[model samples]
Structures are given as C-alpha cells and as structure tokens.
Target chain A: MSREAADGRAGTTVGPGPGTGTGQGTGTRGRTAVAPARARHLRTRLGLIVLGSLLVAVVGTVVLVDQLFGRAQRASLVDLLERDLQRVQALVAAGTLGADFVEQGAGGVRLQFVSNAGVVLLAPDATDPIPLAPTPVRSVTGERAELVGSAAWLLPSGLEIGTIRMALDVTEADADRATLRLSLLFAGGLLALVAGALAWVLVSGALRPLADLARQAVAVDPARPRLARYRGPEDEVAELARALNVALEAIAERQQAERDALAEVAHELAAPLTVVAGELRQLASAHPDDPRVRAAREAADELLHTSQDLLTLARGELDRAPDLSVVDLAAVARGVVDAYPGVTFATDGADGRVFAQPDRLRQVARNLVRNAVQAAGAERVRVAVEGGAEVRLRVEDDGPGMTPEALARVFDRYVSGRAGGVGVGLTVARRIVASFDGRIEARSEPGRGTVFEVTLPGWSSQVEGESAEA
Target chain B: MLVVEDDARLRGLVREALEATGHRVTAVGTGGDALLRAVDGGIDLVLLDLNLPDVDGIEVARRLHADGEVPIVMLTARGDVASRVEGLYAGAADYVTKPFELQELLARVHVRLRERGAGEGAIERAGLRLQTDVRTLWAGDAQVTLPEREAELLRLLLTHPGRVFSREDLEARLYGDDLPDSNTVEVFVYQLRRRIRALGVADPIRTVRGKGYTVL
Candidate 1:
C-alpha cells in the first residue's frame, strides 16, 4: 500500500491493475513509473529556467539592433536632402532656365523658385509666389546654409534670382524601416528557440549529479550497507549524502550486532530448557520416587534465568543491581573460589573496595571467573585488582585461550566459550559494568590462558563511604 | 538428570521443584558439559535453554537429535514469532517462552513422556504386544487373556524390558495413589512370577540381589 502511494504521488501514469495486462502491469513496469515521473517533474523545472533565460536574451538583442538601425537611416536621409538642394542652387546660378525644367522636374523633387524683388521665376503652376507659407524661406546668402524643416535657401549671387524651393518626403525610407523591423522580430523569435534548447542542455547537466544522488538515496539500504560515491563541494546536497552515509553505517553496525547477539542468546537458552523438559518427563513417568527430582528442578530454574536475560537483551533493558554496598573484591572472590573447590582459584588485588550493588558485582565477577574456568578447564582460577581513583579487577585462568574473534565479541550477550552456558552471562556482565560507567576488557590467545579486566572510576573512594559492614 | 544453568539461585529452585516432582536430577551450567553428561548418563529427556554459554541452542538440539531421538523442549526468552519458528525448524519439539508458569513445564514434560510411550510397544520382554493408547494387548494374532492383576503386572514389565522393577514399582503401578506397604509389591511380583512360570516360560522374571525383580 505504501509503495502504491509513493508511486501515485510521483505522478507516473497508472496502468492496469496487477496481473490485469499481458505486459503493462508487470513488476518492472510498475517500478519504472515512479522514477520517470520524478525525473519528468525535475526536467520541467530545468526547461522553464532555460526557456525563460533564452526569451530574455533574444528580446533584448532585437530591441537594441532596431534602435541603432533606425537612428542610422534617419541620419543618411538628411544628408541626401542637403546634397539635392545644392544641385538645384547650382543650376540657378548657371543661368540655365528652360520651360521643361519648370514643367517637369529632372530629379524627383517638386520645386517652385521665386525672386526677392517680388517676382515669381518658375512654378509647376503659374500660381503667384506659391507663398512660402508652410515651408521656410531663407535667403541663400552664405556659401554654407542650414534649414530647420523643408526650406528653400537663397544662394549669395546678389542677382535676386531668388531661392529654388523643393521638398522631399521619405516614403521609401518608411517602407525599408518596416521591412527591417519584421526581419528583426523574426530573427529574435528564432534565436529565443535556439537559446532555449542550449539552456536545456546546460541546466540539465548542472542538475545531473543531484538527480543521480537522489536515485542513490532511494536505492540505499542500511542492512546491505552499500556506500554511495559522493561528489561536489561542501554543498547542502553533498552534506546530506554524507550524513545519510553516517546514519547508514550506524544502522548497519547495529543490525549486525543484533544478529550476532540473537544467535548467541538462542544457544544459551536451548540447552537447559531441553534438559529440563527431558528430565521432567522422565521423572513424571518412570521415576516419580527418584530423589534426583530436586536437581532436575534446579536446572529448570537456570533455564528460566537464561530466558529472562535474553528477554532483557531483546528489549534493550539493563538489569538492576540488587545488593547495594561496599564490596571487598578479595572477599567476594574468595567466597566464589571456595564454593568451587574442584577448581582452584586465587585473588591478587590492591585490597581495593568497590561501591556497588554487591549481588550485581558478584554476578559480574562470577560470570567472568566461570567463563575463564570453562575456557581453561582448569581446577584453578585467579582474581587480581589494582587501586587508585580508578579500581581494576582482573580474573585470569590457565585455560585454553580465546580466538581473536571470540575475544572481540566476548562481552556480547549470549557469548560462551563452553557449550552449555546461557550466553547472556557476558552480555549481562557488560551491561552491568556500563551502568557503573566502567570498562571491561579481555586478553587471550588460543591454547594459552585468558584474562578479564574491569576498571571503574573512583571505585575505591566510593567504597569507603559504603562499607561492607554497613 | 543433569541440570545445566549458570544462575545459582535459579538452579537451586529448579532442583527443588524437580525434587518435589519426585525425580533425581543433576544440574550443570553449560551446553558442552551438558552434552558430555547426556552422552554418559542415561537421561530420559533434556530441558534445554536455547541460550547456552558455549554452543548455540539450535546446534545443541541438532546434535542431541542426531545423538538420539531425545525429546528437546526449548526455553526461549524471546517470544517473537520468528524465534519460535526457528526453534521448531532447528529440531525443538516444543518451545516455552519465559517466564513460563511452573505447572506448564510440568505439563509439557508429561506430554513428551506420554507421547514417547505411545510410539513404543507397551510390553517390553515378552513377545506380547500391547498398545498403551488404546489399552489393547496381542499375543501373536489373537488378543491375550489374563487375570486383571497378572495383566497389570505384565503391562508394567513390558513397558520397560531391560529395566528392573522392584516390588515397590509394582505397588505404585497397581495400587492407587497410596501405597499399602513395601511388602505388598513383593506379594504381587511373586504371584506374577508364578503365573508367568506356570505358562511354561519357567520364570521370565529374574530376582536380583538387593533390587527386586527384572524381566531379563
């Protein structure tokens, strides 16, 4: 259901329901939809950015070119007008007057010339002076002259031959400007399309790494512990990947540790439970009067304890220390040693005392000693301690030592050198030690002896306040 | 009768409980030692804790199963579905997740024993075959007919062929919950011996020194 929801949210086209189509609704198809939809959305955003940038660039270039061309064409039209006016003035100065020149013009300039003495010289029509009412009337006196609008300028002849007036309208210039405007618009539109295409390529390239990282994030599984290759500077995405990898590593380590712990816990609990069931059955049936019933019951209790330890471990609950007091290490070791007469045991410590729950400490100490005895198969075991702000206790045995692997996980829950131990002992011991902010270490090699060391900070000092006698 | 456990108090309690249940038991702490003892000692069944100090409980179960079809009941502290399934797959006949009720364990023990009994023939030494489940006996093809007391005595002897049954064993099987006296079993055994000898077997039941009687 969650997978279906994820697929739906990604906006991939839904096909026929499961097992409904010959090929469309297969596993591969269903899986393919999600990523493609996600990719499509990402691509859409990239396309938009590329297209927008292209539009702005193309439009800006077209506007700039149109303004420059318009100004240049305007300037050239004015120059042509000035040169045509000079030619007309020269023709008048040469005294070359013809009826044809007044009737029809040689050039495409409409003209009417008049004398300053109130005499009309020439006109396309014999209208009187055509009154320079709308156009400017200037005396062509200087060699160089300027006109404000369409104006007639008088040359400096003093003949009073008057000015030849002509006006030119730029109808062809307007048509050419219109054509240039259309071409510029068309080119700008085309350029925008091309730019958009180019931008799509560049932007997608920039986001390619991010897209790949997303794919990796989707695929990575903590249980499998596949590390992803991260690239880029100290960017947010890179940091995210690094953080994810760290979290993944932790999860992988924890999962592995749990699996190993479970295996050991199973081993530890099975033996006695088997024995208890076996013995109980036999006693109930064939040996109701047998005195050995008592011993069988005791074994049953141990199985129960082992089960409890496993339960605690599974729940991640730490066991509580019961007998709170100052415990003399030597005395506790002596008692355990004396209890197991078949196994010789000794203690060598700086007479350090530890403030702790006595029973819990004893449990820790006993488990260590017992583990050593079981490994060594020796009749003798030794306990040693060192004093200071931190107190260290060591249990050594002349037993077959441990392999490196065993030593590494010796403190793990349900680990046992011998076959029948409920593996929870060492696990419980480690938990107890940790509760007191202490450390436990083991040193061993195969076929030699093994030593267990435990160190607790200020243990001896704390012990002085909580005396054993009290 | 070996008790394998690491907890001192729990071991003591278990021993007490089994004693109360009226069986002899020896307690050990680990799986390796338990296996050794199981091999050497004639233990009828093993109440195994899956979490042992040395060997994994499933491995122990496999070994114990391979050694013989000894009934193994796993005690798991973890009550997860996977663990129980795994235990069964690994050869545990039954699983009891802790902390189990004492009565439940006793009941399981009874069930395992009873199931074991159903698998084997009731009559041990004699060619007579008996079915404990249906309570029927056959000598050859036909059903064997015998006096009630004689049939009862034969039934007990058949279940344990090599086992030597004292006079007290007969009283426990024949008598109700209470015992009249130790001598009562002697009389019954003697009469049972006579009835068998009279059938021309010439005393299939043998008397041992100190111990009472044997089918061998």
Candidate 2:
C-alpha cells in the first residue's frame, strides 16, 4: 500500500502563523488581556462576598435589637399596670371609689370590679371591662389587647371580692414597633447598596495599576524591547511589573548574546569555505583536464554546501525575518530539479505564488528534492504543487520507505537514515518553511515510498493591495 | 571597478577573475581605502564586502551611493536575508553571497555595467551573438532584429551562458521595481527563442529545468 493510503496521512502537521491553540498565552497581548480579566473577575467575586456577609450581619442585628426592645417595653407596661392596681385597691379600702377615682383611672387604663357570682361590681371609664377569672394572684394577660394586666384580692369585710383586672392600652407601643421595623429595613437596604458601590469603586481603583501594567506589557515589542519600569508605589502590582521587567531584560540579553555568537560562528565558518572554494576554482581553471583538480573542486563544493547547511541549522528559526517577495514555487522546484539531471524529477503546477525570501525558499526546495532523490535511489521523484487557499508542494519518492520509528523522528536534527548524512537538511528546511508561516511534514511506511509535503500560505492580490496601501 | 575585501586570498582570486574577464580591477583591503578609490573618478563600479577592517562596508556603500550613481554590488559572507535587504537599502545595486561561482559574479558585474550603459559590445556564446547597442541577435550567418526587452534578455543569457536566472531576477532586470507578472519572463524567453529559430538557425536557448532559461 502507498504510504499515504496505509497511514491515512498521519504525519507531523504544523499550522500556519505563530500561535495555534486558544488560551495558550503565546502573544504579549493575549497574556496581558487574560491577566486583567482574571483579576477583575476575582475582585468582583471578593466584593460580592464582603457585601453578602455585611447583609447577613445587618439582618441578625436588627432581629436581636427588636427582640430585646420588645421584652423591655412589655415588662415596663406590666409594671405600670401593677402600680395602677395598687391605687385602685387603696381607693376601694378608703371607700373613695367614686367619680373622682373613675376620672383618675381614665389615663390609658380601664378599671373594672367583678363579683364572685359573675356580676360586675364597678366599671371605671367608658372602655370595655377586662374579663375576670376568680383567682388569688396577680397576672398579665391578653397580649396585644387593650386589657393587659389583671389581679384578684379578698376584701376586709370577709366578703370574697372578685378579681380586679386593670386593662392598659398597647396601641402606642404597637405603633412604635411598626415604625422601628420600617426604619430598620429602609436603613439596612440603603447601607447595603452604598457598601456594594463603595467596594466596587475601591477594588477597581486598587486594580488600576495592574491594568496599567498589562497595557505596558502589551506595548512591549521584541523588536525594540523596552523595560517595563513601574513608577507607581511599591505594592504587589508594582512588584509584579518590576519582576516581569527583570525577566524580560534577562531574556533579551541572552537572545542578543545568542544572535551575536551565531553570526560570529556563521561568518567564521563561511569565510574559510569561501577562501577554499575560490582557490579550488582557480586551480580547476588552471588545469582544466586534471581529474585530481576536478575531484578537489567537487569536494570543495560539498564542503561549502555542508557548511552553509550547518550555518542555517545553527541560526535556527531566529536572527532574521524572511525577505517576503512574491515567489513562484513551480519555478523554484524547476531550478532545484535542474541541478539533478540524472534523477527523473517531474514538476506539475501552474503559477503557485507565495510570499517568501527567494533564496531561502530555493534552499528549502533544493534540500527536500535532494533528500527525496537520495531516498528514491534509482526510482523517480515527483514534485507537485497545488495552489488554492494554501500552496502545497508534495515531493514523492518511489523507493524503500522509512520505518515508523524513523518516520517519527525524520525531521529531527542529527537523525538520518542514510550513512554519512549530517541530518540537518530537513531540520533547516522545516525552520525555513515555518518562518514563512508554512510547515513541512513526512509520511511513509516500511518498504513503501515516502512523501514529504510542504504547505505555505498562498499570496493573494488583495493582500498585495492592502500592503501597498500601508 | 574597485573591489573591497578584507581577506587577502579571496581578494586575489577576485582580482584574477575580473582581470581574466578583461576588466581593469583595483583591490582594497579596507572600507576607507575603498571609499578613497571609489571617488577617484575612473571607477565604473564598486564590489564591496560587508565586513571591513577600517570601516563597515555598508557605510562605504552608502557613502559611495551618496557621492554618485555608480552602481554598487555587495560581496559578503553574510547570506541572511536581513543582511541582503540591509545592503540593498544601504544603496547597493546587487548582492552576491560568499562562495559564489566566479562566473556568476562576473555575469552580475557585466550586467550592472551594461545597465549603466558604460560599455557597448556584442556577447558571443555557442555561435550566437547578441549585439547590445543595435539590439540584434546573430545566429551564425543569420541575423534578426530584436525588441528592446528581447535584446536585453539575450544579452543577459549570453553574458552568463549557463547560469540560471529566476523569474524574480529577470523581472528585476526587465522592469526595475515595477513587477508585471510571474510568467512575463517565460513569455519573453519563448518569443525570443522563436524569433531566433525563425532566422533559419537552431534555437540555442535551453530551459534549465526548474531554474530558468539558459543558453548552453
């Protein structure tokens, strides 16, 4: 079976552009936006918690105050009724229970005397008399009723006096409690609203520095890297900003050092190879028919090619941006195929335009074809370009394919199937393709042919127009 | 032409190659020397290396460009795209990375000189002659008048012979910065080859697979 058919195209797939997954925190803006949103969410949650606890406390306090005040007021009302009863008893004993007594008892209290045979003796005031039961003790009864306290006494003439019940009006106390309830509810609700507003304002104001730090962090560009110095107070937010700035500084320094070292190494390696190649070319020209000279020239060329590959590998995916220009992939493939006349390389595509550096794209195409040719052995290598939303270049070789283990790590550095292969070609190719917002993948099966596919974002006229406007 | 390179051996080879191609060459080891020699009024072109001992080569190219319109070609070991773009922005006419074929470098120099209209001559290869001044192609005893672009393409192909020119290279040469389309070069090559074949001579232009058209 074909590699693609057997494997169902299971290969390493890399997406276009920089960040692929959501919430990966890849870009500076992504990270900055996430930080503020999370902080605000946390602050709002904490504020609601505080407001909830405050409301609970207020409700508890109102209930407790209402209970204590109700008990004290009721007790005082009972005492007043007791004092009135004593006065009434004295009047009865002095035989002065007449119109004057009635007039004095009309102050929010009603007095009534009942006989033991269920007949009323004397009823003071125009209010209803209190219900009396024959009992030899003082008692408070009729909660929220006009008659609140009652008592029974025995006369000095050895005649059994009926119970003397004094009724006290509770309308004023009831009205006061209703007013207290309304005022407490109104005050508690207003306090809750004010507390919530206050918390919102304070929390947002406190988090202003964090928002500022986020904005600053977003504005930090790697191309022109500037430290995110926080000028605010030395609080947690400021400290966080300072720490980020320190980390950025350290990272920038390390990257700068790495770039410098790579450039130095590339220059050092390229210089000697250039000198050697130039000398070899001169020698070859001087002795045009010398086989030894021709061999030396070939060796020099191979050495130069390998050194260039090494430089590309060492440079990796950093140090430079691809020189974006409109390039025809078919043309680049043709150029690479021209170098290998012995191989049966076929290219089929129309005009596949992409934005890329010409030289780098040429290097990538050349490397892939070279690898394919070597892998195909004596068979043919086919390079086909399909252009649509994305331009896909597929290089298929008809030879013994790789094992699953080899296919898994085919693009890795220093991992090669062929003897004496430096193994940096595919690694460099992948890096170059990725730099162009493209990717490279390989699919193969043991004893079958291998196919390496490179996909790049296609160039559009609309994008060209937009860029030209910019 | 004035060549600026820090390395002695590469400079010697470059000097020999240019002299072999029948061009007067002046070699300098420093950017300062290059600047001094560039303004001496007899220099037709400047071949500058990016790395110099005394002053930076990009600075020299900028100064030379500021002085006049003498086309500058940067010769450097730095093959990165950024360096190439930087050299161009610094006013270099072309860029050639190190370990490049001597024939390619010579071809680029000849093209630059031809674009400047410094020398008018006929380039001959494989019994085909391209006269730059009169814009004519002579295939053995048969001759044909050519269009301006066709003559320019023929001249470039004859100058380089077997060197491959990508579409971008050809477009840049033909239209300067105003690119027309991707297939423009292919069409021009096809028309030129047809016109030469109509002159009762065999077509000398061969398409280098995947690279470009070349006359071998």
- Whose lDDT is greatest here? 2
For candidate 1, write residues A151-194 as lDDT tens digits. Answer: 34344463544556654444555567778877877877777677
- Indicate the TM-score of model 2: 0.66
For model 1, the stretches where C-alpha displacement exceeds 4 angstroms are: A1-60, A87-172, A175-236, A244-470, B1-4, B11-27, B38-45, B68-71, B76-90, B93-95, B103-216
Residue-wise lDDT of candidate 2 within B1-216, one digit each (tens)? 898989888888889889988989999899888888876878888899999988988888878887976889998767666666567667777887665667667877987887666325777766777787898778778888899988888876776543445566677556654568778897898788778767776677665333445554
Q: Which stretches of candidate 2 lie over 4 Å from their true place?
A: A1-8, A11-41, A79-147, A151-162, A167-234, A278-326, A340-344, A353-355, A370-381, A387-390, A397-452, A455-470, B16-23, B77-90, B97-111, B118-216
A225: Cα error in model 2, Å: 8.7
In the range A1-470, model 2's lDDT, one tens digit per residue, is 45338358546554343432111123454577687787688678867877887788778877887888877777777677777787777666556666466556776677777667756556643355466532222234555445355566446554547766777777777678768867886798679768977887888777777777777776665533467766667788888988988978987787667756866776776667777777788898789999999889868866776666767654434332332456788787777777676555444454477667666787788788889888885347777777765888888887788886778778766788899999878877877787676877788876667888898876652142111212
Chain A TM-score (model 1): 0.43
All DockQ scores: 0.03, 0.14
lDDT of 1 by residue, B24-113 (tens): 877777889888888885776777777677988777777776686566777666644455545655556556655654556666666666
Error of 2 at A78 (Å): 3.7
